[model samples]
Structure formats: C-alpha cells, structure tokens
Target chain A: MNEKKLKSILEKIHDKNYDCMILTQFNNIRYISNYAPTSFAICLLKDDPIILTSSMDKELAEKTSEIPVEEFKSFNELKKLFEKDNFKKIAIESSISISLFRKIEGNWDLNIEDFLEKERMIKSKDEITKLEKAAGISHKSFKELNPMKKREDGFTEWELAYELGYLLRKNGAEKESFETIIATGTNSSLPHARTQNKKLQTPILMDWGCKAEGYCSDTTRTFVYSEKQEEIFDIVFEAHNKAIKSVKAGIKSCEIDKIARSIISEYGYEKNFIHSTGHSLGLDIHEIPSISKKDETILEKNMVITIEPGIYLEGNFGVRIEDTIIVGKNKAEIIGNLPYSI
Target chain B: MNEKKLKSILEKIHDKNYDCMILTQFNNIRYISNYAPTSFAICLLKDDPIILTSSMDKELAEKTSEIPVEEFKSFNELKKLFEKDNFKKIAIESSISISLFRKIEGNWDLNIEDFLEKERMIKSKDEITKLEKAAGISHKSFKELNPMKKREDGFTEWELAYELGYLLRKNGAEKESFETIIATGTNSSLPHARTQNKKLQTPILMDWGCKAEGYCSDTTRTFVYSEKQEEIFDIVFEAHNKAIKSVKAGIKSCEIDKIARSIISEYGYEKNFIHSTGHSLGLDIHEIPSISKKDETILEKNMVITIEPGIYLEGNFGVRIEDTIIVGKNKAEIIGNLPYSI
Candidate 1:
C-alpha cells in the first residue's frame, strides 16, 4: 500500500510540475509511508523518498515505514539536502500551521496542494474492505449494547458513550474515530452537543464511530419516546433511507443531499435539518466530497459515504439516523446489516 | 472568570501597543470569552469584545458564552470591521494555521503573539479548582477500573481505555481530555503507541486524562512484571519522583527536566528517555512553558504541570509514571492522590 501510494504521489508531483512534495500531516505520512509518528515526523517526497523523524520516533519509524527513516538533526540539515536553486517549487499540505510554514517558507516556492486528499478520496478494494470491517464491528457492538439495561439503571449520557466505546474496542476496533456524542433530551438539540452529566432523558441521540486498521466507521442512532419524538424520527428515517436509496454511480453527491433535504422539507421541517445529509469517510472521520448542498462530485464505485440527516428543535429534542454506504453501479450497498429501528 | 480574563487581556493588549487582537485558536477564545465552539469561532479583542462563530455554532455559542456572539459570514466582513489605518499591527495567536493567516493577511499587519499562552501559564485559584476536579475524576476512575475483569473476559487494549473513559464521565467529567493511550506489552515499547485490538500482555502502559469544566488532567501508569520490566520501572519511578520534587516556583522548567534526565542517565538509559519531562496542562492537553531541555520559563505559583518520565526498550517493554502538580512556594502539590504502586 505504501509503495502504491508513493508511486501515485510521485506521479502527481511530476504531473503537477513540482520538484518535491513535503508531507507534515501525520496521517498523510502514515498513508504514504506507513510510519505514523507519535512525535514530529516529516516525509519529503523527491526522486527518492525519505522520512525525517525525531530521535524519539526513529526506532519505531525505522521498524514500520517502508521507506528509509533518518533522524532529523535540524531544519538547516534538511534545507541542505536540497539544492538551493534547483529544488525551488515544493508542495505542502494545506493544513500546515503558520509557525511551521514561516520556518520553511523562506527558501522554497511553497504551494498548498490537495494532491493527497484527492488521491485519498477514491478507496481501493482493500481500503473498502477495512472500512466494511470497521462498520461491521461498530454495528455488532451496538447490537450487543443493552440500552434497555442502562435505561433502567438511569445511566448518564457520557457513561453510555463510554460504554459504547468499550464495546466497539472489545469487538475489534483500535479506538473511536471521533468523540462519541451521547446527547440526551434537550442537550441533543445542539447538533454537536457535549455530553452532560445528567441521567438519560426521554430521547437520546448517539453519533459515534470506531477505527479498525486505520479505517473509520460512523453511525448515529436516536432513541425516541413521545409521539412528537416518533414523528420527527420517522421523517429523519425517510430522508436517510431515501438518500441511501438514491446513491449510485454517475449521481452527483449534492443530488442525493437534495433528495434527503427535500423529504424533510416536504414534511415541513426544512429549517430543523441543520447539517448535510452525508459525508465521505476513510482515514479521517470527515473527508472530502461530502454529500452537502454544494458538493458536485460524481458518485463512483468504492466511494463510501454516510447519509445522516438530523432534525434539531432547540431546547426540546432532536433525532438523527445515519448509515455508511459503498457506492455501486445501480445503488449504494449499505455496509451494515443492522436494522434502523430500535 | 470570562470577565476577569478579558480585563487582563484588554490591559495586556494595550500595554503591547495593539488596538485589537485577533483570536483564532479555539481554546484561547474559550479562555477569554467562555465559549468553546464545536466548529469554527473567532474573537476580535477591542473595547467591546465580540465573538464571530459559524452559523452552525451560533445557538450553542449564545447559550454557553459570556460574551456577545454573532454569525461569521465571510472574511470580507472581518476586513470591514478593521479600519486599516486605526489598527496597524494586529496580534494573532502563534498557533493559528498558515492557511488562516494567508486568508487574513491581506487585511492587516499580523504579529504572532504569545499573549494568551503567557497569561494562561499561571493558573488562577478558580482554574486550579477545575483542574483539581478533573484530576480527581481521572484518578478515581483508574482506581475503580478492574483490569483483571477486563482481561479475563478477553477485552482488547482499546476496550480498557474506553472503560476508563466511561468511569471518568460517570464520576462527573465532560469528556476524556485527549485520545486515551492503552498500549500493552511489546506495543508499549513505542512511547506514543495507539490502542490496538489485541488482548492483554505482560507490561501495559496506559496514559489517559479527563476534562472537567474545560480544565484537563493527564496521567500515565505502566503496569510491569518481568525482571527487565522491573529494572526499567525502577529507573522511570526514580526519574518521575525526582522530577516532581524539583518542581517549585523559583526553579526553571529545564531544571525539572534535567532532574528527570540525570536519573535515567545515571542508570545508563539516558538515550531511552525519549520525550520531555512534562508540560503545563489546562484547557489544552499540551500547553505552554513546557518542561523540556530548551524551555527556560521559570515555574510560577499556581502553575499546573505534569511530571512524566519514561524509558522505552524497542520490542521489549516500556515504563512511564505521570502526575499533575501545582507549583507552590517551596514544593509542589500533587493533584491526584492515587498511589504509584498498584
């Protein structure tokens, strides 16, 4: 995978008219070189790739990375490796911070490139298989979770989130892809509400995911109670189901988003739908070519995405139904075999 | 707390000869304005300080923030707020990304300022109270965790970390301060080893923390067995104990690091002591005035920092001991009362 990714990156560098591409983002390095450093590590992709890792990370980097790893002495030593005038144009990741950019910008013609991101958008069969395995673990864990037992015991929101994390890991995940959201009652009204220290309320919304083999899986399930809660839940379920149903090769990502939004709009709760219907997921929990209102990326086979449409009524309650889907020729195949209804 | 912090910031800004300061880093905004945003948020420090949060964050911002919150429309709107002649030099956080810096560069003269970091290094009485609460929750949760039960039942390394997270929340923490590290046995050889989906091993190194009311707590404990493990453990414990003892108001941060390093060196394992002795923790997991070889900042009263020292032998095992401490007149007050021997 490292050699394949490196070859593609080298090809991209040549095609994009750059002498070298410098990767500072840890994940980018891990994606291309398989050495994810615990401390600072940089990968300079030239004719021959080299990973510059701190002395602390040298041993691990050398052990894991496909490329040769060297202990980084200083920036001056790194600068000297390249010719002062010949290696002028260098590509940098867009996420490089100002302080780092300031330090390295004095010599090179730095250009922010989305080369890695663009390449990462399309998943290989092996990558998709890892993602499916992650989704499988998350789904299986959710089934094993006795929410009713917690409901009877009156568990706090964070406790349930934490319990779910434990289950995911127990079911063969490295860790949660992102912070598990277990917002209950009115707290769920905030789209990204922090878990409160209170006991579980009438309705609970959980947005969670887990990491397996560096791949990610994301899912959201909202437990409802009252008639009003059930009413909102039904609308969200329709949007989620239809959005997934509409996903296929050649279909625009925004079109699927519109389908979900239009369903909620027809139910007279358009404004209540706060965020996008879905987003692509891979190494990162949230990745490029999201299923938002503006995204025009054409859905292709092996493109995994989520269809999570939520209805949030501030200071009251909210409901969201989400699922991961792998784009297919006719219709996207939902990764998990779990039932949507609780 | 927000008012007091803002007043100090206002005075600092004036003293630094700046009319307004641009706060881009999220934690800095939370420190001064009392709103830790879910998405993007910015603060423009002027006579009447205001926060510009994304539309998605407006509801939460309004509910949580002490300061006035407004919708962030565009960068052009920010340009309009600043009169080019009135504010010649605008101070920005050193941590702000180069991408954001480039976007706002055309608007004004930007100067990287450690304004917030310097002020945040010395914790207030109220801030220390929150840190103490966070530390208390973490220590209590660890004590309550039964690794034997988890391991006997075939729980993975990530499962143990997740269980601790749940317990922390149950004991009244907002969330885990950062990603919990639960590396077991051979995997623990890597200082920053991420949790894997494997069963328990001989020596386990768990570094975990929890956040309470925005303040963070950090702790690391290495469970060891074998003769080699016992030997490494002895060296790490001596370094950890001596480092904590050296933390006092009048001493330099580097002196504390040397205390830790010298002990490991005396045992002929200086090269294996990979990372820093410690780092200040509050709001952010790794904060300013780091206890490292290059840092010259003097330990000040009320400064809460961690004293973590470790020894790693590749493909063998690693041992690390960590604790949070508050600098006092002649000594340091350890936050959590958990016994080192478990």
Candidate 2:
C-alpha cells in the first residue's frame, strides 16, 4: 500500500471540493485497497477510505485490503453514508454504469471525473519494475515458442495463440494481458482480428502481452514475407521508431501520435493507420493518455506507454510494430530487448 | 440471428413505447446483429435495425452483421440520426457507461431496461446445442488432463490450470469462458482463489469453463482428502444433487436456491455457503436469472443454468460441485457426464 498515493488522491478530492469519490471498477478498487473483488464491490475514497464489498468477498477483502473494510448491503445504505458525511458534491468515475449512477442520483452534485485514471497515468518505480518483468517474461516466452518454427510446422493461428499463452504461464507470468492476436495474411489488415483456426499464412502479425504482478506488457511483431509486405513493414517500423523517439517528459501525447501518423503519411499510408498510434498500459491493458489526434495529455517521466504504428491495406496484408516504453527525461526507453525483425 | 428473435425484441420495444433501443454491450449487439464488436460499437434496435460501428470495424461488421451496418463518425452525427427518425423515447441498456450516456442524454425520455436479457433468458434450440458442445469440450479436456495424476507428479496449481486451458483449446474451445480457479488445500476456502504457484495440496477445488462458438460452459469439482474434507464434500454433493433434482420448469429460481441452501443449513453450515447457488451461462460466463435467494425469476423450459452448491470453511478446506443444466419441460438435464467424485 502506497500511503503517498492515497494522500495524493485525497488531496485531489479536496482540490476539486468533492467530499469523497466512489470507485466500483475492480482495478480501481484494487489500486487503492490492494483487494480486487471477484464480484461487485465499491471503494469510497476519502480522508479515511473504506472498501464496501459483497458478503462473499468480505473475508478476502478483510485479509487483503489496505484500508478498512465493510460488507455492502445496498445502494440506500451507501447513500446513507454520503448523507452522514454531509457530502453535497460527490465525485464519480466516468466509467460508472448508468444503472448504478441512477440508483444514487439525487440531492447531490455528481461530477464525472477521471481522478483515479489521472493518478494512474504516471507509473511509480515499483510499477515500472513490474512492467519490466512482465515485458521480460513475454519476450522470453515468445522466443521460447519460436513462432517461425511453429508456422513452418503448419500450426493454426489459434494453436499458436494457445501455445504462446502456455509459454507465458510457464515462464512465470500470471497470464496474457489481453487476447493474443495472431492474425495472418490478409487477416492482419483487421487491427483486432480474432485468432482463426486456419493454418498460418504470410505476413503474420502477432500482438501479444503478459501480466507480471498485476502490471501489463504489450508488444506487436509482424513477420513479413512478400516484397510488398516488406515495403509496408518498413513504413510501419519507421513510424513505430519515430513515435518512441518523440516520447519525452514534456511532450503532449498527441505530438507523439503525430510523429507516427506523419511518418506513415510520408509513405502515403496515413489513412491506412486506422487506430491510434498507441496507448498507456499498467494494471489495465489500455489506460489513460491515449496517443491519438484529440488527446492533449502531456507525457511525463515515469509514464509507461506503447508506441504501436501500423499500415493495414484492405484486402491485402498489414504490418504493425509495437513496443512498450517508459518515458524518460528527454526520450523513451523501450522495456524489452526483443528484435524488431524475426 | 433468428429473425424471429429480432422481431420479438422490436415488438418489446413497441410495447414499452420506446421509439428505439441503443445497445452498446458486445453480447447484446452480437445477440441482435450477429456481429460482436472487438471495440466500441452500438446497435440501434428498430424495425430496420442498423449497427453503427467504428471505421476500423466497418469491414468486419459488413461481413458478419445480419442487420445493416454504417460507420459511426461522432456523437453529434448519431444524435442527428435520432432526430431525423423523430425518436421521442429511447431505451438503453443499464450497463452503458455514464460518460457515454451523458454524451447522448437529451430531451428524449431515456429509460434503462433489460429487454435483451429478458429475451435471452429463454434459450433456443441452436443455443442449447452450442452450450452442449461447449460443455462436452470442457469435460473432455478435464478428463484428458487427468488432474489426479498431475497431483501425483506434484504439479503446481497454475501448471494444472495452464494444462487444462491447453487441453480445452485442443478439444475445440475458443477459449476459457473465465479465469480458471485451481485452488488447493485451505486456499479452496476462497471461492475465487487464483491459481497459485505452490505445489498441489489436499482438497483441490477447480471451477473452470470454456467457450464453444460464443456459448459458455461452466463446471466445478472438488477433490477431497481428509475425513473432515470428505464430510463437508458429502454435504455439498447432497445439496448439489438435491438442487438439480428440484429444478423444474414451473419452479422459481429462488426455490432452487432454497433447496440447495436448506440442505447445507440442515448440516449446520449454512453460513459457509458464501456465494449464490448458481448462475445462467451463455455468451457470458455469468448472466441474468441467477439462482440465488433473492432472484424470483421463474424457471422456464429452455433456460440454461448451473446448479452449484459449495460449503466454504474459512481457513479450512472447502468443497464445491457444479454442472450446467438445461431446463426441460418436466425436469433438468445436465450438460455433461463428468463424475462428481474423483
């Protein structure tokens, strides 16, 4: 439990003139209380924060939570607590479900804020360590799998995904950070293509990750074959490299996005890059400060983000090169030593 | 989709006086449109229902959706479509984020409803077949793993979990429906205990599942060792058996829960039954019409639910037995032939 982080959050609530904030997201509650609920639970962030968990979770919460814990009965009971605290202006996460919001939406000024997300943007030294370990295990497992050999063996995309998942667990990672994407041939054109049972094909785009101590690592590597595929791969590689080079403590996230987008544009594939350049990663696979056109979040030291740039040609193949990096004083440092080309 | 299902949903919307419904949940969208969005997408349920997907999903949506598809540009553009349709009342799923709800909130009467859930509660013949296949694959994989032998080899909980996952994929499962719980020894007391790196111990409690063609299957089995463990296991097994025996078309969900709870209570361990008796499983691992003390939903024919009864003794070993069952006109039919005692 980081007391400093809790104090900082309380100070932010005070600054916003909010008496308290309620967090229902599992990751958010885990971030503050060190107890991730298997089912519904809520963490009330205040001077003295308390986690109200379901009856089934009480034992685990009591054992694991850093703060005080209690059994949550109903929304009315929670509302009684707010009234007891004389909280007129309450803060709620933007991600709170509409149904939940409606249950307790009366006689109060409920402001939607990203208080926890803003705090989680910058990774601490401990968090960076976990991310590094996660990246290390992921890269190690990928090398152990020898995807090229598996492809030569005529393994299906889903088979490769399952094997990679097995390797990650064997290499001391909790699990995959997200669904392992092993898109091949024309299927690579779809950014979030589901792994198919079909045999491996040309231009394999494998975007995979693993979790270590709750932190997440994400990386993408495309194995190009044809000359046309190599051409697109080169453009994506250049974009990915420049995006990382553009990351610094004082730059806006969008500037870094521009660095990647403009590089792809220079090669006449700007519109082909459909998704954002990259996104931040931590306990959650996708986090705040997304590196997109509209985001103006300033990159700060200790912030960990992914710089993935791709060019997906419809009905053809695609190429994506991604690496998780930690923001430095003047630049970004990629987490793992995985090679760009296989 | 079954056109009949879509028509039923449309009829429900008309009956509720809702001009249209906006579905953001992936499963709901998939249920209605047959295209599950990998990222953010919405389905507008109307006479001529259309799915507005992101530009990145345009190709996939066009290929897979049963209904019409269009590229979603901005919230303002979507609002314009609603205005053009002259929609006076709008219905939204309760799970929509407050942030998204706020962006589209306006003069129209926005009502939160479970129209989709109500419709999905009753499974179709096709859905039942998918569920049966999912259960068969899951059970076959468990048998292939041979957990007793793995325990003899002193394998860790996580290793067994990974092996089960690999076997599930090998046996034709898309993926695990939820994180596999492979708790051993006293760790079994934690209903949702994460698989640990420690070697296998007494009283192994495994609750695992997998997906088959978007449908889910869940099952739990506890391997008891000591006399005390066996005693508790007997009580849980009796509760499980009786609960399944009590399951019929006309009974209430709570009645089934009471049958299970009372059996455990008769043995003076009612407080140890921490979580609900069971829950419905479909595309999602846990769904509506859960078999709990509070749920008063009637058990209808074609409704697929699990009958799991467990006794968790905190700081001691625990035992649980579960099986997915399809409610028939007269009684319940278990999905798989997995043995209760192993």
Candidate 3:
C-alpha cells in the first residue's frame, strides 16, 4: 500500500546519489511498513525495504510489516553488511542521535536527508480519514467531561486530566496524542504547562488530543471567568479564527503564522504569544512545516495543521484557543465542532 | 547544591581541553540546575552555566534553575556567541540530535562527551530518597489496585492501566516514568506489548513505574493462572531474586547479568529472555551501566538500578518479576516491600 510513497522516497535518494535511506522514527517506519515499532527498529528504504527490529519486536514486525523483518544484532554487524553490499551512499534522517550516527559511520558517504519528511507531508485519503476520526473522538470526550461544570467543582488539574483520558479511550481513541495539559490560573501562562495537583482555578486552560488508528488530533480551549480573562480570550479567539480563514493550498505556512501573530500584535499582545501559531500533525503531533516565522513551506492540499493563538501575562494568567484544520484548494476545513471558548 | 557535580564535570572537560559542554537532555539539566525543561531548552556549562530556554519557558526556568536563564533566539546567534568567546573545544552530549549538531558546527572543535552521563551515574542521598518514595508509591498503588481481584472482574488492559495511573497519582507520583505495559495472555509474548482494549486474561504481565521528585522507579510483576504459567513464573522469580542478590559495589555489571543468564540457561529458557537483565534509573528510566553481557562498567555504591528477569514464550504466555535496588558496599537494598507473587 505504501509502494508509491516508498518509490517517491527512493527516487529522491537516487537523485541525491544515495543508495538507501535509514529511517528510525516510528511514524516514518510505520508509513512504509505498517508496523510502528515499540522499541529500536530501522527501515532501510531501497529497491526493497527491510526492517531490522529488536528480537522482542521481531514477531510483531513480521506479522504486520509489508517489508521483510530481521532481528537486529549490532551496529558493527549492520556496518559490515553495508560494506559487503558495497553501498556507496547512505541517507539518514536528521533526527538520528549522534551516538547512533557515530556507531554506524563507515567509509561510505552518510548525510542527513528529508526525503521521508517530504513524502509524508501530503496526507492521503486514508490518513485524513483517520485524522478526522481521531478529532471526532477527542471532541466527544471533551464534551462528555464538560469543563464548564467541572470548573466549578473542586478537582485537581491532574484528576480532571485523568478523567479526560479515560473518557477519550472509552470513546474509541487508541490513546492520548500527547500529555493532556490542564494548566490552571497562573500556570496557564506557560504554553506547555505541566498538570498540577492544585484545585481548579479561574481561567482554566486545557490542551488535549487523542489518537485513532495511529493518527493524532490536537485542540486547546481556555475557560475564562474574570472580565480581563474574557477580554484576553476574545483577542486570542479572533486571532485563531483569522488564522484558520487564511489557510489555503498555495499560501506559505509562515503566512498563516503572520496572520495570527499580527492580530495578537494589533492588541499589544504579540510578545505574549510565545510559540508558533500552529504545527503540522499526522501520526506525530508535532510534524514538519510548522506555522512559524522561520518556516516558509508552501501549504499543500490535504495537509493538516493546528492554529493556536494565546496571550500569556507572565506570573498572572494566560488565554489560548487552538484547533486543527486541513489545507484545501480555497479554504481550510476545521477538524471538529468543539467551541472556541469552551 | 550541584556545585560539586558541576565541578566534577568541568574538571573532566578541562582534562579533555574542552571549554564548555552543551546539554539538552531534561534529566541532565535537572540534575545540575534543579530545573527540568518542558520544551526546547539548552544548558551551556563552563566556568559559569547558563540555560537558554524558549520565551514560553523563561519565566519558569528563571524561577527554578540554579543557573542563569536567557531567552533563546536562534542557533545562528548561539554560534556567534561561541565564536566570540574564542572557544577552542566545545563538548556535546552523545544524545544530541544530528540536526542540532549540524546547526552549531563552527570553527571551534566540537566532539561528543559523556561528562553529564558520568556525573549522573552516581546518586546523592536526596536522589536516593526520592527514588525510594517513588518505588514506595508504586508498590502501594499496585497493592491497592488488587490485580488478583481485577483479574477476576472483566476489565480491558487499557482500563486497568488507567486506574493504576489514577492510584499512582493519588498515592503521590509526578507521573508515570514510562508507558505502563499491561499485557495479558498471548499478548505477553511480546516483551514491550502495548496496552490493549482486550480484557484481562490468564498470565497478566505489567511492567510499570512512576516518577517522584524527578526520580524514577521501575518494577514488573506477572500474575499467573495456569500450571505452565506458574512454572515459568517460578523460574523468572528465581532469576530476579538471584540477580538482586548479586548486585553490590565493586562488581562488573556484566557479572550480574551472567548470574541471571546462567540460571535461565540452566532452566533451558535463556533464548526466551530477549532484553537486558536490567538498567540504571535516576531522573531517566533507562540510564547507563546496564546489566547486560556487553556492559562491563563496575558497580559503585549509591548506584540505583533495576533487576528484572523475564521469559516470553511466543504465542503462548510470559512471566517477569522486577525490583529496584540500591548498591551498597557489600549488599543491595531492595527499594520496596512488594511481594514476589500475589
């Protein structure tokens, strides 16, 4: 099923004078072989892909992978195999650890390549379906938890986070896409806040998602109480709305970020919006082509991304609104029906 | 204070003619500065250490980090700073990404160094106390879970895993050290099996842990139902007990592995044991000085590690027993008072 994707990557490697590509990221491997390793595994994408996985994972890999599976012995052994095969060039993912890079270094040329990233950027119909399903499950779970009512009840941030996770799984999600962020009151000022044991406070912020069939969904909402909190929330919500409206197939990812950032800046809260406006998400929550000032990747049809705009007053409180959307020919398609200011 | 730890690392770097070390691993940073990063951040160690964190993390980092904190702009700026400092040799952790390694490659001599790993190998009294508490909390939570009774009641692996996590938080734990593995019946054959929605079956193998005060505690226990399952369970328990008994200061780590492997081999189940005997744990669950045939590091006092011996029969069932222990001069002190079988 991934023949087209593997062929595309192989052609890129060949054009770059590389014999094969070494893929270690679980999502990258899964995209090719339909087997996401639970431990160390390498996918050698060449004329015919082969996966070398730990012995503990050998059985699962064999049962699920479209490619041939082998039990990994050592880097020394893999280096010898490459030498024996007389492979002239090897392309490795930029995410490879220096330790592994050093271990696999040989006489052959080895360099970082983004062939897999380029291949995985555009979502297929099957992948998009999974993404929508994951988003649906997340929305259903969030609604069931009812943050508006939960905010009044005294419950620690972690307790509510756990309840959301339980609800997500019950709604048919495989697992949480990432750690549920249940930052409350002043803690919400940190974009990536750790869930605490403190009871619920005003301006509750929760950024949570779930996985369905190896696809991820990301969403964030802030429940405001005070007049100031509501005012900040309105500004963030405006930015989030405008950014989503600006997404299209031909526009640059950074352009979308600029749209949201400019909206926040208009209200003198530009500096407070700390992180990127959004990021691409698929099997992994944080993918390439981030909606950031530094990124200039052109948005493509079927590309999934999140637009999260926030205003954080250091040591005071923060308000954020986020939603996942899909790039379209003319307009962006938001993933779920979750309210912006829930 | 981490003054002594910092001194040790600086002395090692000085011996290697390195001016400063760039560290990004959250645990290593936390060990030195008492501040664990929630997002992208870097700790530069020299005569004076400074942490360059994302703007979103600067407020928390400044409050928690013992060292100075600065907002990170870009790698180009960092490289310019390194050049201005006239650094002759710069040290980096082996775990650094090839992407980051390429970003800061400059006129200065850049090389992989293990100063942080070497410094973190030995635990302090406070770290050990935290580890003990984490282990105590994990044991208490597991006992309260009453897995034996849960086995009788019909509940999916994911459901029970969620409940265990809830109990872990209730008893006092920052979070799970790693993903809780709740494998049951045939799924137990895969050592690192994913927690599934399938109901609990015969021979439930759970490998779970929790974090307390940034320290980790790992343990595993298999509840067996059938005669063959009990037989395998007995052999694994014996190997686990013997391995724990063999742990002490001044012995090679491989020697302990040999002891465990020899027993499993005598029982004709050596091939069934796929992974290492155990691994060291501190802020991170898997640390260096692994109890494996290839690792020959000498055990030292104040080192915390786990002794887990498991046997997996593919397509059938698996059993494992694990415990965390502290290496003393002439003995090993097991972390908690959990029973081998329940």
Q: Give DockQ for candidates 1 onward, in order.
A: 0.60, 0.76, 0.88
Q: Write the per-residue lDDT of candidate 1 for residues A15-105, one digit (tens) a residue.
A: 9889889898888888887787778889998778889998778878998898889988877777787665468789998888778877776
Question: Model 2's lDDT to the true fold?
Answer: 0.92
**Chain B TM, every candidate:** 0.97, 0.98, 0.98
Q: Candidate 2's residue-wise lDDT over A82-184, tens digit each?
A: 8888889999999999999999886789999888999999898888999999999999999999989999999999999989998898899988999999999
Best-fitting candidate, scored by DockQ: 3
True contacts kept of 1: 0.59
Q: By how many angstroms RMSD does model 3 differ from the true structure?
A: 1.1
TM-score of each: 0.93, 0.98, 0.99
What is the DockQ of the complex in model 1? Answer: 0.60
lDDT of 2 at A200: 97
Docking class of 3: high
Model 3, A23-125: lDDT tens per residue?
Answer: 9999999988899899999988888778999988998899899999999999989988898889989999999999889999989888999887887889989
Per TM-score, what order, best first?
3, 2, 1
* Candidate number with the higher lDDT (1 or 3): 3
CA lDDT, candidate 2, residue A131:
96
Of models 1 and 2, which has the larger DockQ?
2
> Which residue window of length 10 is worst by lDDT in model 3 chain B?
B1-10
